[model samples]
Target: MSTPVLVINSGSSSLKYQVVDADDGGALAVGLVERIGGSGHGRLTHTVDGEKHRSDVAVPDHAAAMAAMADAFEQHGPDLAAAGLVAVGHRVVQGGARFGHSVRVDEAALEIIEELSALAPLHNPANAAGIRVAMDTFPDLPHVAVFDTAFHLTMPEVAHTYAIDRQVAADHRIRRYGFHGTSHAYVSRQAAELLGKPLEETNVIVLHLGNGASACAVRAGVSVDTSMGLTPLEGLVMGTRSGDIDPAVVFHLARTAGMDIDAIDDLLNKRSGVLGLSGSQDMRDLVDAVEAGDADAQLALEVYCYRVRKYVGSYLAVLGRVDAIVFTAGIGENADEVRELSLRGLESLGIEVDGEANRARSKEPRDIATAASRVRVLVIPTNEELEIARDAVRVTGS
Candidate 1:
């Protein structure tokens, strides 16, 4: 068996992990610990070799969660010790401009990651917490950090810079640092492979449409432009995020409604998007509601898909000529109606989706565009964990 890498993706209240084989990109085990620090019982579910194991443990914090995860591995088969783990990979969301590639986690690296937490308040702290705990638990193993913003660092200034004063922006480190870099990089490369083209020669657009959505214009396997700006809240309409709203909206709310910055921030980041447009934020629920003739849901669907189409059009113009438009992540890969609606009326742009092909339900990557269509529309499921593991192996030279 090949040396496995333990990939950890720690969120605000959850920890997800996978043990992946470095040699062949196979998942040896996968698990999650949810509801951490919550009053109610936290849940730990682990799977090894397709056999599932679950526990309702009180995981009061990241440390406790890590211990429980170790317990799960011991109770389940394929223990970490037996797996011959080479390294532990942590998925850090915002690496900023400093980290353009994955690196071995050292004291200086950890300090930098903590310092950059200002750019990702919701993500970085949690990621750091996981890192600390993982380091303590697996003291002998090498730890690597694979950043989500690393791949997008290749974006040019025109695409990543804002229209604000250069001095002020530079002083504050305020520039577009697109999220989902790992997913974009993996999906775009997979799209090139699916098209039977070399990655360096491929020009593709990757639409990662989960609850948190973003579009990337990847030309010749590099991100020339992407939809997300300084934060994830600046991108496409997400489940709860109000993407691409006028900056004045916050000021308007503050002036007229006497809303504070924190309240306004919460409104835009936690209470907007499809959730604001319609009653529900879940795409599946919205689709069902649309079929049931819910006007609000229909409008929400229209607005969401329209935003996607606009980004696709913008990216098409950016790339000039596109090889494929790849759809990955939750809603992008599974929601057929969303894909169809997003790509509709783009035939003139050489983007056409075959109804039959688009409707096909499969996990494998496949083209959804008509043979006559100039640009291919494809659905490639994302594997961020695998990508993190691969990066970890590469950085550790394992």
Candidate 2:
């Protein structure tokens, strides 16, 4: 019997799961359980026989959502009756300062993962709850915990360290813990593959821009620098969160404006960013507004692209000689305007994009670099779920 692994990525209200043939590292079935606690309704989409099965059901909790998913797979995919299920790979949000790599799940592991919840209050507890329920549902299957912070563990002291006082930092574990490890790792390797160069020999900058945006510097296939620091709230502006901000703004809003800490946090984390600047976070909306002569939208876009360009320039300096500059994720993959605008006028650094090629993205990786430029530019969609699944296979002893 061929060994199979299950990849489970649980969000606050979503569960992304897939069955993969570990031998070939190929996905067999993929689906998601969304709107766990909301009225949007729960649905499952599974691939089989070249067609997909989708259905709606009530999922008040992650456990129920996960159970429905297993039922869907058993009723839809390869046999689970006598099937010996291997390990389940869970996408754990915060492994904290303790774990630097994927580890086999155990009681102690779960406790430690829970302990780190204070650090990632929004993500870790929810992620841990999903893990616990999965363990209960599949008691016989070994599970692996893959962390988002594991890959960025390579960052040096100087880069990860904040400029704040040492005693406070040591007390609070306040240091840069870069997220999007799986995507950053995979995208960098793809960049190397596209260049037909050794993974350990080249440098590249990967812009991952989904709802939460970030920049990464891949030097010789390992992450050397990244924009996200201490939390996902840092770095480039995102869909709903203000990225970079003045440290004093928080205190000023509280003292002078009578805003409290919680209110300020909610405002920045939930109501700010492109949404705050232009009343919208979707790039499409911003672009349309700009075309229709909306000054605020145009300025929001300008600020977004300008920050990306600045990071590209800085990472280029950090790398010294980058082989390629890559873009991935939702906005990075589909927003040609953002890509083109960000890479524009970079000819002085040998980082020019071919205007025609930039606008002609299609299936498979293609170089969009200008014929005269030295660095190759590319648009590659990220699949962090696949990476998490692969890591799960390795850790579960499959």
Candidate 3:
């Protein structure tokens, strides 16, 4: 009954992979191949049995990366050919409206993924390329694509629809397609379980706070509304992304700063967020700066947490009656100060975080809410890889 599945998240120049056991919900092996196709040497880091193995080599392309990955498994641990891999799951960032759930990857499905690259110019092409190379490498294994956008497809039409020029918006497919859905789905289910309520009856607000953050309002285990819109660049203030900015800022910058489309995009996505306000992007660094009385860092933290609080309040309104609020991902899980600051002043709204519980250092999921609080506050660590693996197995009937 050991159903092992390999989950792949292919980036533009890097490949991250994990061999996850769907039955046990544990990662058997995890690895990363970085700097693919770069002019300099690439690096491969593979870990198994809590041991790390590293190698530096020339990874000229996805094909070379896949071969390197196979070599790592063969040489270090968990030989892939003998591992009984049920399927290979890929993390495709954009499924568009075409794919509402995980699907077995075929030539036709691959083509659709590639065609959707326009929606995720920076992600889908690399995903499709990796799928092509992975299929060539493991032709016998069933390959499945679990989209980050798929879970949010349940959003009602009013929630997803943009009130722009209807014809123009429709032609461009300009509707909200929230990201971080895999984490949202995984964390929301965990929240429901923690509440000891049927997932169908539980209403939870899931805040996936990583370098890229999003808030999802899950009513009856389905995404009703999310902070992100049309792209990852929207929603909460991310590490480097200016989330929820006025659209006219772009036009104003074009007219005044003479910035072009690409330049503006780079500014909003790479040079904004906490980095734009303070010279740092990492929450740890920002926290350090704030502790040291760095005014800019303090302001950055304020902006970040204020945005999160705004979404929490809005989602509270959306859900009407909530069961719990769950926080997951790197920042949400480890940054105690962030969790506290984000939920600050929400006590009147029935959301209160216990100081000691919030500050406790534990990896396991636990409640951080005060005993008297009406709504429970939870810190649930997200396991997106395991979620992907499980979805892959279910989709392929493996």
Candidate 4:
């Protein structure tokens, strides 16, 4: 693993990237090109070091975004050539049951990932396209796919299996394939380290709250249970995705609302959650409205935090001996109000967040638990790209 690796987290319309030193696993540079297909006015902003380098790139697709990201690297801080990015690692959304671990991308795997688009219509195809573009852009480099669901492959049949017909489940591969595995896996280890115990002996819950959110219960480092089921939309409320809707709602919408399958799909994936509950997708606006006495915004925040709290309490019971509760991802790491509200009134379960410490914004992982609390509430920033790079190195022996 002496050669550096470039890790790409490709979304439907954006590509987030980081270059890591293969030998030491240190991130040399990281940036993201967001808002790809927003409107006639589109922008790609790459922030490296302390400066931001932006462009008005006509990114009609992810391929264009990837090229713009490359241009950003050339113009910004670290030079890729000097960075020695010998290999590339991709964060694939749904690798399906076919891949349980990171593997070198082959023609067969690419086809399988494409086949999985039905499962993750909003994600898999875009991810496959990004992989294809990466293969084209860096033909000589070894490309690896670190799956989002691979870490949760450890879930027992009872945890992953649904209460449906066995034949239907088998036909559709309809089982829990949790997302944010890299974040959950990374945070679990960090929580164990912070507790100074062997991961196998430690029990922790990880809550990943970003544009998308999910909760996981990690026992002995393996994901024994997680909130995300089959897809990212099954867990906690998110920016634009509904979580844990009634099974009847799908059928009801199709029947009464005259909505087709794709229409319903788009509604759940793109127009629901906090955005639908409140009026804005951004939590900042929601929070602002809540402070200004907006009932709907307040309700959205309450619902969001309550769902997280429910999972935390449930996971504590599942683990039987809770070591820590980890808060990570964008909202989990930065939103003080979300953290404070989510862990409130959990002292009986040995989980407590220090009011003063929770408000302190630190870049490094910091425990925000009150000294008296038995279970520590930690704010551990997730580094999924770095984790992908480490795995890529391990799998490839780069």
Go through the candidates in order and give each one's C-alpha lDDT.
Answer: 0.93, 0.86, 0.95, 0.87
**Tens-place lDDT digits, model 2, residues 8-83:** 8888988988776666656777788888888767887777656788899789999889888888877887555455
Query: Each prediction's TM-score against the native?
Result: 0.98, 0.94, 0.99, 0.93
Candidate 2: deviation at residue 257, Å?
2.0
Clashing pairs in 2: none
If the candidates were sorted by their lDDT against the true structure, best first, what order would they fall in? Answer: 3, 1, 4, 2
Candidate 2: where are CA atoms >4 Å away? 1-3, 22-25, 38-52, 78-85
- Per-residue lDDT for 321 in model 4? 87
Backbone clashes under 3 angstroms, per model:
0, 0, 0, 2
Question: Compared with the true structure, what per-residue lDDT tens digits does model 1 show for residues 90-192?
Answer: 9999999999999999989998999999999989999998999999999999999999999999999888888999999999999999999999998998999
- The segments of candidate 3 whose C-alpha lies over 4 angstroms from its true place after superposition are none
**Model 4, residue 170: what's the lDDT?**
97
RMSD of candidates 1 onward, in order: 1.0, 2.0, 0.7, 2.3
User: Whole-model lDDT, candidate 1?
Assistant: 0.93
**Candidate 3: Cα lDDT at 244:** 96
Better of 3 and 4 by lDDT: 3
Clashing pairs in 4: 1-398, 200-220
Q: Write the per-residue lDDT of candidate 3 for residues 109-139, one digit (tens) a residue.
A: 9999999999999999999999999999999
